[model samples]
Target: MIDIFGTLGPKCDNEIMLKEMFLRGMTGIRINLSHVKLFDCKDSIDRIKQAAKEAGTTPKILIDMQGPELRVGDFDGVVSLAKGYYQTLGDEWIPVDEKIIRAMEPGDEILLDDGKILAQVKEVKGTTAEIYVKRSGGLTGKKSIRIVGKEVPMPALTDEDIENLKFASEYGITGIMQPFVRNRDDLLAVRNQLQISGCPDLRIYAKVESMEGVENLENYINDCDEIIIARGDLGNAMPLWELPGVQKRIAKTCREHNKPFMVVTQMLSSMEKSAVPTRAEVSDIYNAVLDGATSVMVTGETAIGEYPHEVIKYLVNTANEADKKIKQNKTGE
Candidate 1:
C-alpha cells in the first residue's frame, strides 16, 4: 500500500487527535522544522509515539531540515511592489543585498523570496545598486532570497538545522528531509553532518525545489534514500505552470532508482479552511498517485486546517481508491 504521510501541526498535535489521524490512514508523520521549536518538536514526537503505540501501528517520523535557505532581511510588514518599480532597502533600490554589489555587475539576475519574483541589477556602485524588478509580486518579511547567476556560498546545514538534526537523532526519528538540495555535494555535506551527529542510519529524503536541484536530480537521488517533490518553493522557483512536468520527471527518476518519492504542497489547500476538498484538489491527489508517486502529503490541510481529521480521511479514501483502481487496471480486472 502507498504510505499516507500527513504533516503534523497544531491540529494533530494532541494525543487524541493524532490517534484519530492514524486511524484515518496517516501511516507517516512529517515534522516541519521550519515552524515548530526543537522542544515542541520533541514533545510532538513523544505524543505521536504514544499515539502510535495505542493504535498498534508503527508510524514513521520524518524530520525536515531547513537547509541554507536565503530570505529577505527583516521587513516592516507585508510590502507590495508594482511592476517596473523598485524598493529601497538600506538606502538603495536594489533587487538583492548590497553585500553582492562587488560580485554582481550589470544585467545580473536576482531571485528573491524563493525565486517568486525576478530582478536584474541594472547598475552597481559602492555597497548599493539600481535593480529593475523583472517580475512583480508582494514582498513579505523573511521570504527566501537568492542570486540567479551568482552562486551564494553557504554551509549545507545551518546552525539551527544541526540542532534540529541532533534532536531528531536523540529522539530516534525514522528519517530526515533535507530541504532545498542544490547538488550532490549538498547531500554529501548533510550526510557528513548526520554522521558527525551520530545519525548515520537515519533515512534521508532529498527535496527537489530549485532549478539546480531539478537539474541534478539523478545525482541527488543517488545520494539520498528518498525524494520529496516539494512544490511550494518549487513553484516559487519556477513558473507554476511547469510544476506538473517537473513532478512527472521527479517521479520517473525516483522510480527508475527504486527510491520512494512523495508529492507534497497544497494537495488540499481549500481544506485548510474547509472540511471538504475542491474537485480540482481531489484530482490533483489522484493524479499524483497515478503518476506513480509513492506518497502524497497534505501540508496546511493537516497542519492548520479547520477540519484536520476530515482532510486526512478524505486523502486516505481518495488515495486508497486510486490505488485499488491502479492495481485493478494492472491486473486487467
Candidate 2:
C-alpha cells in the first residue's frame, strides 16, 4: 500500500482534523521531536488514537528523534547582521552551545537554518570563533546547524530520546525514526536502547540524510525496519539539484532489498502557504512513487499550513492515482 503520512502540529492538532486526515488516507503521524518534547505531544498523541478510533483506522505513531545532529541553542530573538563582520557561533556573541564553539575550526563552513545562513570560520579562540557570514540570513533560535565535511561529536541518541524510548510502549508509539544514521552501528545503538526500554516492538526507520549515511547505506539497510529519504538534510548534504535523483536511487535500493521506504520533505511546500500545491510538488510525489517509494510524507504542509486538509487531499489524490497506475501495470489487462 502507498501509505500516506502527515506530521502532527498546530495546524492539524484537533481530533476532528486528525480524524479527517485519518479517514482521508493518512496512515501515520510523524512527531518531529527536534522542536517539541515527547511529553508535550502527549495530548496530540491521545488525540491521534482518539481520531484513529473515530476514523476506524489504525494509524501508526512515529516519533522522529533528534539523534546526534548539532543545532543552534536558543536565542533571545533574531540576530540580524550584514555580511563581512566576524562573529562566533555558540559564543557569548552567538548563544549556541560550547560543543559548537569547540568542534568547528578555521576554514570550516557552517550552514545554519538548513543552509539558509552560511558562516565561514576564520579562527577559534577561547570560547569564541571568529567568522564571516558568507550567506546572510537571520539566525533563528534552536535552528539546525550543519558543518560542511564534518559530523557533530554527540552521542547517537540524545538524553531526551532515551527517556522517550523508556515511555514509548506506554504511549503506544509503534515506530521510531532516527535521523542521521551513519551506519549499522548507529541503528544498533538505537535498537539496543529500544530493546532495553522494553520497546522491542517499535519498528525503526533509519533516516538517510547525509553523505556519510548514504555511503554506509548498505551496512544498515537490513537492520532498519524501514528507510526514510529525508531530503531536507539530504539536500543540505549535497547539491539541491541532485536531490531528486538521489531520492530515486535510495528508493530503488529499498525496493530491491524488500524494505519499505519513504520519500519525505517539501513534497507540497507551496501548500504550506497556498490552498493549492505547485505542479512541481505534484510531480515530485508522483516520481517518488514511480521510483518505488512505499510511502510519501509531508511535514510543514500539514503541520503549519493554512490549508491542512487541502494538502492531504492533494497528497491522497496523487498517491491514489499512482497506486492505481502501479496496479494496472502489474496486471495483464
Instruction: Return the TM-score for each candidate structure.
Output: 0.85, 0.95
Worst 10 residues of 1 by lDDT: 88-97
Give candidates' CA RMSD values in order.
Answer: 3.3, 1.6
Question: Using alpha carbons, what is the TM-score of model 2?
Answer: 0.95
Could you give candidate 2's per-residue lDDT for residues 1-333 as a string of tens digits? 888999988999999899988888889899989877788878889999999999999888999998978887776879885577767665577776677778878899888887888889898887777888888888877788887888766778988899878778999998999988998889889989988999898999999999888888888999998999999888998778998787777877888889999999999999888988889989888878877788889998999988878888899999888888888889954
Q: What shift in Å separates residue 261 of candidate 1 from its native position after superposition?
A: 0.5
- Candidate 1 residues 1-333, lDDT tens each? 888888888877899988988888888888887644565677788999999888889999988776866655555656665669765543433234455556667877777665767778787777676677878888876566666645565667878888777766678698988888989999899889889888899998888878888888987788988888999887766667988888888888888888888898888889888878899989988888887878888877888888878988988898888898899999999
lDDT of 1: 0.79
Lowest summed lDDT over 10 consecutive residues: which window, candidate 2?
A: 81-90
Number of the top-ranking candidate, with TM-score as the measure: 2
Q: Counting only residues 3 or more apart in sequence or on different chains, how many pairs clash (N, Cα, C under 3 Å) in candidate 2? A: 1
| Model 1 lDDT, residue 154, Cα | 62
